[model samples]
Structure formats: structure tokens, C-alpha cells
Target chain A: GESVGLHLPTLSVQEGDNSIINCAYSNSASDYFIWYKQESGKGPQFIIDIRSNMDKRQGQRVTVLLNKTVKHLSLQIAATQPGDSAVYFCAGRPNSGGYQKVTFGTGTKLQVIP
Target chain B: DAGITQSPRYKITETGRQVTLMCHQTWSHSYMFWYRQDLGHGLRLIYYSAAADITDKGEVPDGYVVSRSKTENFPLTLESATRSQTSVYFCASSSLAGGLHEQFFGPGTRLTVL
Candidate 1:
């Protein structure tokens, strides 16, 4: 069975420091990958995404790197803040049909220390 | 402007009871998804709809049923709730515009089956 997995179950970082979370996926057929941030009581929010065609993509305060060769994916947060403390998830979607059906990884809890 | 919303942000029910989680999106993005979040298992897709009246099962849809009578609404019903079904459920929507399939998620519904 194809699965997406996170290396760490929890991560701790200091405020103003950079945080890096890693993920590994099993299915090579997966073409789309996504990163999500979930608060304690809210649903998962989209952070960043990268297609297999691209190795990296950057957004405001966030960057997503994909290494298809090693089947690895990572999300980096710059200047980690208290508000950035939450659970982060990585997801993958294979190039199946037209619709987007994604499989999510376990998750990594990011905690920012003040 | 309500982008996406879920009814009864929290719910509690007994085993064998039937429960329904409501999801509505104003974006009308043409794709809607339902996912469940558990402790160790990050987010598992339960069902999705491509358009009105079009529905399909996702990774974990055995105990759940879904319907897409309208484009804005996609409801998930648990035929007979079990203790294992207690988790947070999220609804997401995405569009294929610009060849991008990034998803936008709703707040989520927390269900506890006692």
C-alpha cells in the first residue's frame, strides 16, 4: 500500500528561528504534493504545494521542497512564531483520473518556543 | 464572506446511533472532499464529489455515506456510529483553474461517539 509518512511526530523551534519538517511518500506515481497546517480546533489549512514536475516552490514565509529521486518532501517555515505552532501534514495525490484524491501523512506537531 | 463552513462544529453521540456532518462551500469549486483526522493518522479521505450528483468513495469510506445533491453541499453520514469513529472531520474544495488543484479547507466538525 502506498503511504505518506512524516519523519518526526513533533518538532520544537524557537521564535525567529527557521523550522524544517520532513515527509516521505511511497508512491512514485504521485504527481501532486501538499502541505497543510492545522490548529487545535480548526481544520487543516493549505500551506504550500509542489507538483512532481517542479523540485521546489516558495510562498510567504514558507517553502516546499520535493525530491522525487528519494521520494521525499519537506516544508520549511521561516521565523517561526507563536501563531505558527500547530500540526503540519503532508499529502500526496497520484495522477489518477481527473479529480484530485489525496493521501495524507501522519503529521508533525510544530511548537514554537517563545 | 463565508468561504467554507461545517455545521455543528462539535457533536456527541452513542454507539450505533446515526449521525451526519454537513459541509458547505461558497466557492463552488466543482470539487469537494471529506476527510477524517485521528490521533496518529493525520487525515484520511472518506469521500469526494466532483460536481452535483457525482460522488465517489475515498480511502476510508466503509462506514460512511455521502451525497451531493447540490453543488454547494456535501454531507457525510455515518450509518452506525462507533467509538472508533470519534474524530475531527474536515471538508475541502478545490478548482482546476490554471491547472492548479490546491484545496481550501473548512473549519471542521469534531465528533465524539460514546
Candidate 2:
């Protein structure tokens, strides 16, 4: 069973500071990865994604880094804010899937301290 | 209204009762997915549809059934709800345009089976 796992279950960071969340995946056949932000009582929202062909991708104030050699993925958020407090999930999509099935990590709860 | 939406934002039922969660997307993206979110399990895919009348099971498809009569609707039915089935369910839609496969998720439906 290929799985995506997170190193920490919860992360605390101060406002205006950068936040880094890490994820590890077991599926080397995964072709792409996505990061999702899920607030309490809401569904997960797409944050950023990177294809396996690329090592890193940036968007807005966020960056996604993928290390295929180490089977690691990370998300960095700049200037963490109160609104950014939420559970972040990392998902991997295998290239062999037919319907774009994705495997999601348990998630890391990001807590921003004011 | 232009994105995905789930009905009965919250639901409660007793064990052995049958329940259905509705998912509709306006994008007609050609791909829809149903997932259940638990405390430590994250989002586990239950079922997915590639197009109208085309469907397949995902990672955790047990105790659940799905149908795709049309492109916009993909419903998940629990034949006999159990206490373990209590969790938040999310519906997402994605397109293969640009080969990104980035999914857009609906708000979510919270179900509690006692």
C-alpha cells in the first residue's frame, strides 16, 4: 500500500513568519502532487500543485518543492496569517491511474499565533 | 453556483439506515470524485466517475455505491449506514485541460451515524 504521510500532525507559527510543512510519499510512480488547505467545517481547497517533471513550483506567497530522489514533498507559506490557520493536506496522483485517483496524507494542522 | 455543491450540508441517521449524499458540479469537467474524511485517515476516495455513465471504485469503496447518470451529478449511497461511516464527505471535480488535473472541491457534507 502506497501512502502519503506527514512528519508533524500540528504546526505552530507566529504571524508574519514563514511556515513550512513536510510530507513523505511512498508511491514513486506518482506523476503529480497537490497541496490542499481545509478550514474547519469546509472542504479541502486547492493550494498549489507540481508535476513530477518539475522540482519546484511557486504561486502567490506559497512554494511547493518536490524531491523525487528522497520521496519528499514540502509546502512553504510566507507571512503566515490568522486566516492561514487550517489543516493542510498533501496528495499524490499516480501516473498509472485511469480516473485520476489521488492519495491524501492525514494532514498537518497549521496554527498561526497572533 | 458555478462550482461544485453538496446537499444537506449535515446529516444524522441511525445504524442500518440508508443514506445518500448528493454532489453536483456546473463545470461539466468530465471527472467527479467522492471522498470521506476521518479524524486520522484524511481523505479516502470512495468512488469516482470519468464521464456520464462511466464510473469506478476508489481506495475505500466498501459499503458505498455510486452512480453517474449525467455529467453534472454523482451521488454516493450508503447501503446500510454504520457508526463508522460517520464522517465528512467531500465531492470534487477536475478536468484534464492542460494536464494539470487540479481538483476543485465542494463545501462538504457532515454525516453522523449513531
Candidate 3:
């Protein structure tokens, strides 16, 4: 089945540096996209989300970019801090009549070096 | 005060045994979801509920049963557990107010079936 996937399994960045995580999704019918962060022993925490109607959305020090033509999505974190180190996952929700189904990517581990 | 929680942070069960994982949320979200996270699979939805008494199967729902008897509780039961069922399970909740929105996740439960 076609699903969402990440480009890299792990990424390392120096503190205060910018970090970028990439994701690819196969479902064009998807209308909603979300990014989540998971610490070592916790559930995924919601970071930011973007809708297919827009190409980009920004939150506190975080930005999400969506490219419908390539079926790609990316998350950028500015001034990466040690506390920002975690596993990041991208989820896509396909538009199915009334209710939508969400699919998650494998995830990318972000390591911030202080 | 208002958050989602799961019981039995860790469990070890034998194959063919019956086990149930419990999820609770203080917020009265209209939608609740169950997802399993495996090594390579990331996170896959097992089941979801729009409201009390309304449940639906997801990507990998086989061998898993879910019920939302109450708005704040959603439980997942494995009638006959298998070694392959050993994985981390997470419970999430969201309000379906605006089509689809960000989901709040609970601390996962690690289940090891031997």
C-alpha cells in the first residue's frame, strides 16, 4: 500500500543551528498534514500542521512546508536546542468523504549536539 | 488536568493470552484513536472512534478489537495475542470540529508477548 515515508532515518545538528526533516507521501487525496515529536520514552507530541490548501505554515520557531506537486513535506526547526532533540514523524490524512484516515511515516531521529 | 493517559506502561504477556490496554482522556474529544508503533512500521492505526458507540477499523486492525463505551475511555483488546503483536501502543484523542485537527497522544504502553 502507498504510505508516507521519511527521507533520512537520523539527523544530527549543532545547537543553535537550523534543522530540516523531509517526508514523502504517496496519497494525493490527502488534505491534512501534521508533524509530531517524540522523546525517548513518551508519546508523540503535536508540533505543527498544514492543510493542502496552503503551501506553508509556521509556528513558534518551527515551519512546515508542503509541496503537492511532488507529494513532499518538510519541517524546519530554527535555532535547534538540546530540548528539541527527538524523533519526528509526519502524518498525512486523506480526504475520505466524511471522515479522514491518517497515515504516519517511519520517522526521523533528530540529535542536537550542544 | 486535561490530558490523555494509558494504563500499564509496560506489560509482558504470553502468546494466545487475552490482554486489554486501557486509555482515558480528561477532555471530552469526539474522536479517539489507537495506533501501534513497530520498529519499521512507525505508527499504524488499529482503530478509531468518532464518538461513544461508534468505532471503525483502521490500517492494521486484525487481531485487535476496540470499544468506546464512554466518551472519555477507549480500550483495545487482543483476543488472542501473538508474538508479532508485541509493540508499543498509543492512544490519541481529537475533536472533529473542523474536519480533522491535531491529536493529543497518551504515553504509550509497551507490550511484550512471548
The clash count for each model shown is 0, 0, 0
> Could you give the candidate ranking by DockQ, starting with the highest?
3, 2, 1
Q: Encode model 2's per-residue lDDT on A1-114: one tens digit a residue.
A: 468999999999999999999999998999889899999888888899998999999999999999999999999999999999999989888987654367889999999999
Residue by residue across B8-108, what tens digits does model 1's lDDT show?
A: 89999999999999999998788898988888886888888888998988878889999999999999999999999999999988874623236788899
The alpha-carbon deviation from the true structure for residue B39 of candidate 3, after best TM-score superposition, in angstroms, is 1.0
**Interface RMSD list for the candidates:** 2.3, 2.0, 2.0
> Number of the top candidate by DockQ?
3
User: How would you encode candidate 3's per-residue C-alpha lDDT over A7-64 as one tens digit per residue?
Assistant: 9999999999999999999989988888999999899988999989999999999999
Per-model TM-score, in order, reads: 0.92, 0.93, 0.94
- At residue A103, what lDDT does model 1 achieve? 73
Index of the highest-lDDT prediction = 3
Which candidate model has the greater TM-score, 1 or 3? 3
Given candidate 2, what's the lDDT at residue B62?
Answer: 90
Q: Candidate 1: where is the Cα deviation over 4 Å?
A: A97-101, B96-101
lDDT of each: 0.88, 0.90, 0.91
In order of TM-score, best first, we have 3, 2, 1
TM-score for candidate 1, please give it.
0.92
Better of 2 and 3 by lDDT: 3
Cα lDDT for residue A63, candidate 2: 100
DockQ of every predicted complex:
0.62, 0.63, 0.65
